[model samples]
Target: MRVLIVDDSKAIFMMVSQMLEEKGHVGIWAEDGVKAVEYLQENSDVDVILLDWNMPNMNGPEFLEKNLTDSFTKTPIIMMTTENKPDYIKKALSLGAVEYIMKPFTNDILFNKFELVDEIA
Candidate 1:
């Protein structure tokens, strides 16, 4: 799987990238939603997007709202953030995110979410 990881922190990206690599998947890093959108325009083959809720340029929910009418909407998005509130999760799902993974998650949790996404797809 080719996963786009949209997060402001390099450390978090590195961690997720390593996990993906270990599982034989490719991980692409986008510092913010603006960059993610730009990348998506040129490369729409991405399997899934791992989005962060509090980015500087464009947050996860903002990205979800903006892409609702775009072709990238076909790509499944999983909001990965520290926001663990039920309201936040519900809002994300309502806005177009297929799944939500709270931050500080383990590798098992991350991949398990991926499996859930596959089932949904």
Candidate 2:
């Protein structure tokens, strides 16, 4: 699957990319939500998106609004953030997020989540 990691932190991008790669998933990088949107525009084949909560050009929620309203790309979004409040989770899901992963997640956890997601879908 073509997975896009949109985050300001390079370390997080590298970690997540490496984890997904280990699971035989191709990973793509975007520094912020703005670039992520452009990436989706150029590579509409992307199956999943991992978006961080905080970014420079546009935040996760802001980017999601555009994706929800824009006609181009409305692919599934998986939020990755440190925020663990129920309200935040509810908000992201309300905005059409398919899943939410807390910060500092390991490859094993991610793999398990993916497995469950696949089964549920």
- Per-candidate TM vs. native? 0.96, 0.92
Backbone clash pairs for candidate 2 read none
Query: What is candidate 1's lDDT per residue for 5-25, written digit by digit as tens?
Result: 999999999999999999899
Give the per-residue lDDT of model 2 (tens digit) for 26-76. Answer: 889999989988887888888778889989989999888887799556666
Using lDDT as the measure, the top candidate is: 1
Best by TM-score: 1
Model 2 scores worst on lDDT over the 10 consecutive residues at: 112-121
Error of 1 at 104 (Å): 0.7
| Candidate 2 Cα lDDT to native | 0.85
Return the lDDT, model 2, position 26: 85
lDDT of 1: 0.92
